[model samples]
Target: MSAWQDDATRDLMGLGGRLALLVRGEGSAVWDADGNRYLDFLGGIAVNSLGHAHPTFVNAVSQQAAVLSHVSNYFATPQQLELAATLKRLAGTGEAGRVFFANSGTEANETAVKLARLHGNKVGKKGLVSLNHAFHGRSMGALSLTPKPLYQDAFRPLLPDVTYIDNTLEALDELDWSDVAAIFIEPIQGEAGVVEHPAGFLRRARELATENNALLIVDEVQTGMGRTGDWFAFQREGIVPDAMTLAKGIAGGFPLGALVTFGEASELFYPGTHNSTFGGNPLATAVGLAVVAEVENNDLLANVVTRGEQLRAAVTDLPLVTGTSGKGLLIGIHLDGPHAGAVREAAHRRGLIVNAPTDDIIRIAPAYTIGDAEVEEFTRLFAAALADVNGTASEENNA
Candidate 1:
């Protein structure tokens, strides 16, 4: 094993084993310690919204650090106030909307959980609902909503009154919404192999939640910030969730998370209900502002749309690929067999970076700003890797 890998294994709790000692990155590419360059198709699990080391993101952090970094939420800064307004604007939450910033997707979801609890306390409803096969987060509250045995078994005696259902209208229909305080839904279950809810599922969920006065909280931690061809995945369904959690790509790789509340849901939290020491610190919010502005000014969502279709088209016909799922930049390459792990290794060895979220699904969520060159290079590397593994090429090969 490499020296860095040994050191990492001794120190870090995750990463399985260090795949590469990534030293530097620019645009849509990264270089390992040994100077091996690879196209970054994973984009830090879709966190690197502007790709690695974007100038705007860098400048924002530097400028904010120089001016002000943290005030412990006792006093708000310009970045904090501005970011809140920007988020509300983007979410179309109007004047009644409110924002609470945290440091990660998990933290954002945790805040949403608090909102759910607050709703329960305010009314007679106390039940919380989340979908099966969903990946909310690993924290106690978020984990309770995540029904998977592997993640939940070790952390037994989780939050109570949490129910799980599939992301289908039929599943939603069976639920007694009046008893539920909140229903947490993800437009696309990114960690669950980029699985998307059925068509009209979100809209139907909205109707049911409204009819019974249940809070509909959308977890856009993975699917938001234009990853799914829209500002937020819920936008595609034309539904405004009662509350929404956002992170991952929000700060262009900076550690930032936000809980956005809509309408009456904004009234759920009082002053003493929540606090985070480093949440929405000036440095993080400034970076977030820069990232969001860059996306808006550059029209990167359109790029995500075109690049996603381009990359998906380039790879769907590959020998080992069965089909593709998800939307825009967030895509899952379905394999013919349970060879996602093998294909991931093969792709990594061939100077491409992807991940196997499941035995049969290789998730690819690249930079939203990826262009023709990046797409073409990704195709070449991915195809060569697939050929290396299965030794088959399509008659309609484009690479």
Candidate 2:
């Protein structure tokens, strides 16, 4: 067998049966071993927010590597401090915020869950609540906070005192709020087909948590950093979570994550409570600060808003499309039938890229800087795929 085939065969089967193409990538494009170039709509599942090989990101990483890279948690680094300051400002945490850095989304969420529990203990609460269809992370702690059974079923005996609630404020009704440690939620349900909680659901959750003395932890790992055309998605909802976990786009594809806490909640993580050896490494934080600066200076959030409207408008009138859900660039189009996989395959054949988490929903989280022409191209290609599938069905019926 060929080397690539051998590698594929040896790989684990944990990816839900979806095999990936081995490719060489460059800004918004990837070439398979067979020299097929595809426009990458997936963008490493929304991690490459700055596209690929962005000059600013490249320069920042190079410069920081020359200066310093890793320092143990015992010592402070200027890059880490600067990045934390920038994030605090972006998150609107004012002067009362503090940050704990980690190396990935799961670690970031792990930190958030731990801090929530600590805060709950401080206030004498006992339980925690998260929405159904939510995905926080894969670690035991974050996994416990994740409500999806399929993801959690395999790993039983997760942390105790974690409960699942519906994605509506009504789900909070009649609960003994006094025992709830905190209410954790994602701004947008990225993995569960981009489901969004109802309007005012977040605000109402905040109100309930405050009334009952609980913390509100917003998992913005996938929805923050202009992915939804805002610094943070919760800002648009008019609610500020007590604690927030961020990753994915924070470092523009570098492995980095952070937990930011405001008010008295920042004191939950006392010294010696938690630490990551490579968490706030100079290289990652330096790259992160650059990503944040680029986002602000280039006004990429504005671009996300403009391009999101174009992409949504192009598909709003399609017969096969039921509707598009989400805000800004993190969009999900619901289709009339379970043809998401087929449509995605067809788009791939046509040198386009997309994802299907559900049988009928196609998730489109392309880089925020994706151009209008690319969006138009994807819309045309998707429409063609839909028509082709319908035509095939009609012919089969006639035969």
Candidate 3:
């Protein structure tokens, strides 16, 4: 019997099914408990920025843990202060900004929501806006901003005065933004089949938010920290958001999230407004500093662009693949039919890890350090999996 079938296993909330019991991982590859090796393209759902056990990340975490791991928010640590400054510098906000640390993207977003609400209180605007397919987080405030019915239906009675609109310039023009407090958007929607915001859409949102006195909150949990070939995907469009939430890859697999605020939004919070006991602790921030250094020193941003283009080119023409979407390592392969699940299963049998976010979409977020040979190998395995699935479908049709 499988480990999952054990009677002692608790029926806690989780993803649909357990795929494999991973025992060890290193540099974009993992080995299962059963001794099968698999190339990891999902990267812990885009959390493993530098891949498993990178020397820099490993050393930093190890050394920091030995010294000091956790310190209450009442006290200050040099690592936390340095990490916040580094984030501000990377954002180009300079001294006009500040950061709030949390343990995950959801908490970071919760902090952003609080900031927006406080800012809105000054102008008497309590409403919030978000995209139709946008995903902020699963917390009550963030969930209210998220537009997915499946996740929001049971969590009814979410935060009130939140509106969801389609990601289009026309929709923006039609939006009644007079009462809106903030507009939350993902530069590239990860959970919604990797849907990207349209060209000039972010700029338009910036203008609308300014006109309506609403805060612009960009959720960069999946696209930030060089995941989209740039330090942040929103940078490509050349628009500055009042506040941005970051997580996933921020600390290169460490559990850390940050809410960075710029301009007037930076001073929205006062003493006792918000705090986290474990946020930005010595261990997490120390590793975060190291991750930023490695990404810059190793010049992984250039590699991301080159490898991203190469991957798209290699997969777009494969059999059954209708098209490929997204930028950098955050890629989505659209199949011509509802065969994404079958294709994923076939890839698994062949020792590859991928994610089917939707019935027709396969999302791939390989490590930023993935090499040319690994990409080529993944493409070969994926093409073979497509052929196997297509062949099986043909047999079923004839039968």
Candidate 4:
């Protein structure tokens, strides 16, 4: 029997409700006790960039564990410094760069919010603006910025002073400038079905923030780390944010998150103002460095671009799929009907793992290392799933 099965059934309802039984996972596939294999296109919600049990990540973790793992905030490790320096190099240094490590994407967003608050108050600014349908995280601070009622209604009276604006350049027209401390936007809205910003929207956002003397913060938690065929999605837009929050792929599925800032904004948090005990531990940071090194060395970004194009091209003409959105491996399938959940379940039964962003949107976040065979299998299973869900064929067992 799978330990996760009983454990999950008994204690884990805080997350999404139970769907299938998972016995084990390896590489880009998982299995249930019933002996079903699923090609995992979801990639653990975009965290397993290198895929499950990648030798590189495992070896890096094991080697670092043997050397050293946790070193408290009172001390610094070479790995921590290396990871920070790598991020700075990737994001461009000489602009006064710094990093704060955390344990997850939510914490990363929390750290960014804290830094923005401190910086805003120091400059006598108040409040921040975030986009509608944006998802930073589930933590209180990050949640406060997320403008959805379902995710917010349960936790009322969140942190104050957040303005929700649709992603329209003109939306900033009437807002009070000085009171707005910063504007938080995701380069690609991941949870909101991968909705993309309008053309030149990021440029206009940068202009608005500059005109208001407010910072622009990009939440790249789901779009960073070569997920979008670029180091950061905002880079493709030719816009540099004041600060950026990252996680989900930093440590190749390990618990690692970082808040990176440049320019004078980096000086906002002094040593004692903000800290995390296990944030920059040598183990996670070492693995993070390894992950970054592998992505670059293996040319995974190029792979992402190529595979993403292949995937889009393959699925573009499907009958049930209205269109596709997103870049690189982070794809969102817009469906013609509200049967996405059914389609997801159908695909699961057909030996492919995918997810539904909502009732009519399917999200496909395959590993960067996924091969052509995996892509073809996903498309075939997805087509079958859509057919089954749409009642185009009689119900087929295990499909």
Candidate that would win on TM-score: 3
Candidate 1 Cα deviation (angstroms), residue 176: 2.6
Enumerate residue pairs that collide in model 4: none
Total clashing pairs in model 4 = 0
Candidate 2: deviation at residue 47, Å? 1.1
Encode model 3's per-residue lDDT on 118-211: one tens digit a residue.
Answer: 9889899999899998888999999998888898999898999999999999999999988999999999999988998788999999999998
What candidate 4 gets wrong by more than 4 Å, as runs, is 1-7, 392-399
Worst 10 residues of 2 by lDDT: 13-22
Arranged by TM-score with the best first, the candidates are 3, 1, 2, 4
lDDT of each: 0.92, 0.86, 0.92, 0.88
Q: Flag clash pairs in model 1.
A: none
For candidate 4, the per-residue lDDT at 321 reads 84
**Residue-wise lDDT of candidate 4 within 1-399, one digit each (tens)?**
356667887887767666568778787888877788888999989999998889899999999999999979999999999899999889874548998889999999999888879978987887988998999998899999998898899999998888898887677666667788888899999999989988999898888888888889999999998999999998999887899999999988999999999898888888688889999899999999999999999999999999999999998887678999999999999988787888888888789888898888999998889888888888888888887776743344237
lDDT of 4: 0.88
RMSD of every candidate to native, in Å, equals: 3.2, 1.8, 1.3, 2.8
Q: Encode model 1's per-residue lDDT on 76-154: one tens digit a residue.
A: 8998999999999999999999999999999999999999999988888899999999999999999999988989998
| All candidates: TM-score | 0.96, 0.95, 0.97, 0.95
Candidate with better TM-score, 3 vs 4: 3
- Runs in model 2 lying further than 4 Å from the true structure: 11-20, 393-399
Worst 10 residues of 3 by lDDT: 6-15
